[model samples]
Target: MSSPEQTTAIVDAATDPARSPRSLREAWLALAGLSAVFLFEMLDNSILNVALPTIGRELHASTTALQWVTGAYAVVFGGLMLAFGAVADRFGRRRTMLIGLALLGVASLATAFVSTAEQLIAVRAATGVAAAMTTPGSMALAFRLFGADGLRVRAITLISTVGLVGLAIGPTAGGLVLAVAPWQVLLLVNVPVAVLAMIGIRFGIAADAADELHRDPVDVAGAVLGTAAIVLALVAPTLFVDAGTGSWVPWAVTAAAVPAAVLFVLRERSARHPLLDLRLVARPLVSSGLAFKAATGLATAGLGYLVTLQLQLDWGWSPALAAVGMLPQVVVLIAGGSLVSPFVERVGLERAAAISAAAVVGGLAVYSLLGRFGYVWVALALVLVAAGMRVVGVAAGTNVLRGLPKERTTIGAALVDTASEVTSGIGIAVTGTVLAALFTGDLAASHWTARQTAEFQQAATVAGLTLTVVAALLVGWGIIRGRSAPITADDSDSSAGRDDSPGAEADAPRAAQHAG
Candidate 1:
């Protein structure tokens, strides 16, 4: 319930662009803080990947232990995102994010003292928990800062660009650093990033208002179910990549996910205060945006995994050369942020989302049909997918937030990220499974026989085509669902009607007071 004055203030905040930050420059500190949060998410995994062998050597770790070092992070991060999103919305997004940043700094600092694989894995898991708390808040806060769609798009673009650069250069940078310094420096870098993010967010953003937070009791049952479902989902993909397709372990894990997901949905439907309101998610725009994001994630990750193998294992390129070959994707992801605003302006957000999503499918098609012909086709596929991913990443996320109630923006952002993370895991699983099924003999052998080469090409083609069809269906569904009329802030569920009760009156002014 809210008073008329609170309602008016909320509406004014939604409709008035003049009151919002005029430009990225005007809100540079806040944006910097948000961008730094994103940079940590993107850079942490990529940089550490290059140091796995070094870590194993120094720590005398087994292969399984090394896998957990990265796997633990992904599992913990993905598993906790939705729960944390709900927590942030109820308590305070800023407070939760700042706390998460501090935790990230502490966890990263602990990496330097790690002497065992188990210890390192524990540290990575801590960082993942921190990431889950902070990452969604970044986008939620940015969306809250701006009233205009244009400004929001630009802000997201700027933030994503910084993250993309971090992701693109992480491997190379890690390699260079490992040449001269200890691997500990890589994780240690997050301390400074966490510090900067804390300063900017603490000072630059306004505090949360009472009216901006939901007062309902937290749905503990729903949170547990949701976390279990997501954890199983994220884990199944890695199991597929590690264990062969015939292994019953991955199948059992996959089967467990179905029940967990079903139970989560049931709990949410019945919960007095569900972690994620299913009704809101079923809204045309939110569902469609998630579909688009999932499609892009599937295509981008699947293609990257396959191409890396094709270049190195099949084409006999050196590790450094294969890394160089991936520049097409890296370049586009880093440079394509500028294109998002203009493209969205020209085609409109919905159209841009659809077009970009289609391009991802199209890119997969190119790789499937012609990649074996030469490096040129693979590079083209990379560019197309990267270009599409760059646009849809921002557009789809914006659409999801736009469709959600202002108070639920953090969960909406989490949904966007969760969809991407889950599907990317699935993507890698699909490609790896197909390759394993089709290609025989030692995949990692330095010298492959002619039959193995032929088998590898066949496996890649089949995998690529499989991804293309799946991505196309997802993108097409998204476009169809997204065809529904757009939901503006004024007409959103939170603001569409006024509450006239006396109790509501007191709540309104509190919102108005913190409207800035």
Candidate 2:
């Protein structure tokens, strides 16, 4: 659609009282459009991951290039999401979402035609930009469609469940596609899906432009600083894990991340319209809530890489069978999602987070003993872990929305997804590097089979133990912290920053019914 046509259609939808979802039929249709966007965007992360090995061989790419292909989208997405969310808030979410569909279509087409690894990586990055643009708008549109808390919660849960389903199915779907056709065809699938999604949005979703043309500055400096910091942090670990690479680059990037992070925080504090408020991190619930969500990413999308490598690289299963083997975990996620609301309502959000972490730790503990036990046993353990992760995700997401004001729904969605995406990248980097190191254990091949076997087991053990320690810390934090009130979104105000008045930050956004 042309820009004028899109604007006109969306504006007409917004103004047409008849188009609004006052009826149940219209509301369900609206949810379908928004949820479809969420599904396609997140599904990209793991779906492409499955194609990495195929891509490497076809393009004559190195291991590092494969890693870049997998990580580039997430790195860019994590870096840009907050800025895009804030943009959606300032502009119209409907308009932004339409643009996102267009970009996604273009990027997917480019990915299908890439001849080199570098081009594939760049095209993947473009898709990340598309995701950043669309996701906040997707969430905000849902929020606008349903004002009642009960209805909104249900809608968000359905959207999240679809996302979970996408993550669950991505590898399996990718494998299935590769079984019949080349990797390029797999990417080309997105083009048609994108078109269908745009049609859904055009007809079903109501337009919701910003009341004002402009409210706050876009904070370009903060976005740049934040992007630099995240990219450096992610790259450091990947380089460190490369067997022959020097420590200098990793250490240098790590060092640079500190200043960039510091500057990003400062920039947000001072900017007229900050991409995200730094003080939101200061809230105990917000911080812990964010962490809980990240853990979900670690267990779900991130762990998919580890499992894929193990299944395809180590066990030598065809991608098709490996994906089938993953079905148990998907079943667990679906079943587990139903349990989240009741569990959070019963135990409170903080305590539920700790419990979820414990499940992850326990699952990893089982995975650590994969050599001793079989893949079946490891799969069973992951089921428990996946269930727990779902609970943590659902609990944290509901609370985060409650804490954020209704007006800043786009920004809140951005922050929530950013935390998960960044940590997913971290989790993939940490675990994949460990596995890669093990896979490349000795230059002098002494019992090559024996050496690879030993290293593979060792890698699993190390990654499991590392995550265990992290989850255990979250357990402590969740248990000891005082009950935090759900925080609201902060407006463009230096006054709250200046006045050290008691509870000044607390007063910024209106608190809703706490899911806790």
Candidate 3:
């Protein structure tokens, strides 16, 4: 019994002549489901950011412990995404989605009730794993349902919109809840949302099997190595900082991670069944997409943290006010994502992505000098950065998904999500560490005397400027590289030509053919 929306969607998909009505319909449902699912994910992402101060006060946490509240979730979340991508391939997407949602809902409920920092981190980690499982599957389902050049643009737009909103709303929502309801309420909010999404999937979605489910063995080794490499990369800085190892720890982690990654790549290349098909991702479109996404994450995530600090510490705004000030960012994000999507599908992905990446670089550059200006100027700069970031982010995801064969959608999505998480975690740690260090130095420059307050303000401005420049450069590189790359797939073609025979994965060339 499909819902009326589903029925209408299927009918429209069938009769529309662009593609099957059923396909369009499923795309819409997946869009809605993914949007809802990402709301929870992003909610969790920013929720911890807002609650950190409160959690510290209540739990008497040290800085190391405080970091774990965030780090724990990230480590588990990112580590599990690739593994879950395989699970989605093995099981049906529908069942995986429902089960993942259920686990997330339960974890959220438990998170709200937990009392200690350890308890919160543990519960959040569990929730992160659940989210990892659900996120990649949502993407896989999107590809399966939408097909190439079908409803992908609209779906990505909707997902981007939801994610942006969730990111924006998290701080305010968490603050309001903390004001009236306790930290637990933040965790509990996922329950109702998950219940609704469960209902939606069960009734609205039909089960989908991966196209080559039986042909390939799961690449367990690659999965482990990939997850370890990413997680180690994210945690290395923190480990260096926490262990008081100065410079050696991060260098060591980097050294280890590089070889592990190389080994994983070699293993993936030769293995009969790689966890992810490396050859496909090695394509210009896919590689560029991953790089673009990572750059965008580094820029926005770092900048967002800096802005929050500026609002709260320097401007003396409350959490609620800071959150409200960021509302404009959310609007810009959705608008930017929505604005670029149709053009991406029409003009081709690489061109569209390149344009968006340029916008991001340009925006970050424009905003770079803003910290020394008045609040209004800074606010305007934020809007520019947000809009640009939204555009690039959506284009990157759409391009990567389009470049992959349908069966590799989950793996590709895992790469996308994992890169995003890993990059963001680095952004937060690096930006936060730099700002903290700068602030401390400024305080000392004042001789720990009467000049403390004014010096703090100066430090904040400097920190913002520093981050703006770094973000600008990262985005600039992506824009230039993205322009030279090929777009993902043929806009007019379905993947109907894809061979489903055994070893079909081996037969597929990457985007290079399209480039030529």
Candidate 4:
């Protein structure tokens, strides 16, 4: 009963000598390279955040212009990831990744010569383009490097841990570097990272085989429509945050996204060779994985934004103190990687995903209900959410790639990331809008009266609860959908001679069981 794709994946894993790495030690070089790519993605924006004010002063840039310096990167990166994922699958993952690393190095070096905010924005966008090209490939390449499910989970956990460490330290590291070097050094550091990534990947991983590469022509029309829909969706959240609910721009953008998405789905359904095969996505494992990832992203982003605001604005903590206060979450994130493999082994992948995702919901609920009482509640909330995020991040992504065919792994990775990115934006928007609606007066004011303080806490609670509700729904659906037969070598053996056609009606149910 196994689907053709699932059957092929098992056979390939069982038979392929090329993907021989069974443990992290066996593939350190290639993994190190992929980890570097992930580090850049997580660190770039975070490191730049600390230097934004300095850049504004040095360049005499307006507030709006300064925002674009960061925004441009996010917009371009989120917009192009899916398209580039498809491209890498067709052409070559290694080839595309090396080219992207080169572009990243060049773009990072350009920071030294950026004399204006506009120039900086352009450079950031270029890096974003580079990120789109390479980020998804990192996960895909890592997955492809290993044949066993356990090794895949461990490899992804290792890479994600490195990235999480970078994210945790970025702002503090940026601050330290700024004291001794120009702001440009923050970006210029990427040059070395990119160089190391190139060496590791080029020397460590093998080139793609002819059979692994896609043979069909790229779906240009689907690409265009998909990109447009994602771009508009990303832009709408920012508009809601910046322009407020009254602004017509965000509403207009949101409206435009619906039609673009519809058109893209329609085009894909009708296309000879779609950019993203909707049929694959319809598989329970893929859908469940995406939903779990989306839930984590939403809760993580929302909780972080809300907590930062409460720490600095409501409690009157210094920026340094607020950063230190967030250390619990950071510590748990970096340390929790060690727990993922054991937990998954003990409980199984689907159960681990469900439990961890529920933990995220639980953390949000804890904060919503008890965060107003004391700092202890806030720290607990952060720890719970961080722990859950760490596990689910690895588990959900592994589920997705495992559910996919080997040839389509890069796009599968891209879909996982896109789900996270889009939902993170929505998370921020939902919390921000709720805060805006319930709390009156200047949020950035230096001092707040007792009434303002009370209103802020109320707003935070309402916002947190709202986010928790939304996250719960996502997690609930994921758990329900994820409940299928676990994909295993045993199933593959029994179903090897059965109908392995893509058009088989029973394929989805059979494939769903295999994702675990």
Each model's TM-score? 0.91, 0.78, 0.79, 0.91
Q: On residues 47-139, what C-alpha lDDT tens digit does candidate 1 reach at each position? A: 999999999999999998999999999999999999999999999899999999999999999998999999999999999999999999999
Query: Model 2, poorest ten-residue lDDT window?
Result: 491-500
Candidate 1 ranges beyond 4 A from true positions:
1-18, 485-516
Give lDDT tens digits, candidate 2, residues 1-516. Answer: 336654554445546624434322335556677877878876876787788888889999998888888678767777787788878777767778889889999999887568999999899889888888988677667756643333444566677788888887787799899998999877777788688778767766766544422477778888788778877776666665563343477667778988998999888898877777776555565566676666656655445665666666667678678777777777887766666655654565556666776677567656656623578875877687787777766556655554554446677678778877666656766776666566665523334476686677678778766765665565556545425543233422211122124543232211222311
For residues 446-474, could you state the per-residue lDDT of candidate 3 as single tens digits? 13433444555555556445655665565
How are the candidates ranked when ordered by lDDT, highest leading? 1, 4, 2, 3
lDDT against true structure, model 4: 0.85
Clash count, one per candidate: 2, 1, 4, 4
Against the correct fold, how does model 1 do in TM-score? 0.91
Question: Lowest lDDT 10-mer window, candidate 3?
Answer: 507-516
Residue 2 alpha-carbon offset, candidate 4, angstroms: 42
Give the C-alpha lDDT of model 1.
0.86
**Better structure of 2 and 4 per lDDT:** 4
Residue 186, model 4, lDDT: 97
Tell me how candidate 3 scores on lDDT: 0.66
- Candidate 4: residue 218 lDDT (0-100): 97
Where model 4 places Cα greater than 4 Å from the true spot, the runs are: 1-19, 484-516
Those runs of model 3 whose alpha carbons end farther than 4 Å from true positions after fitting are 1-30, 48-63, 112-115, 148-150, 210-214, 239-255, 311-321, 335-338, 342-347, 428-516
Which ten residues in a row are the worst by lDDT in model 4?
Answer: 491-500
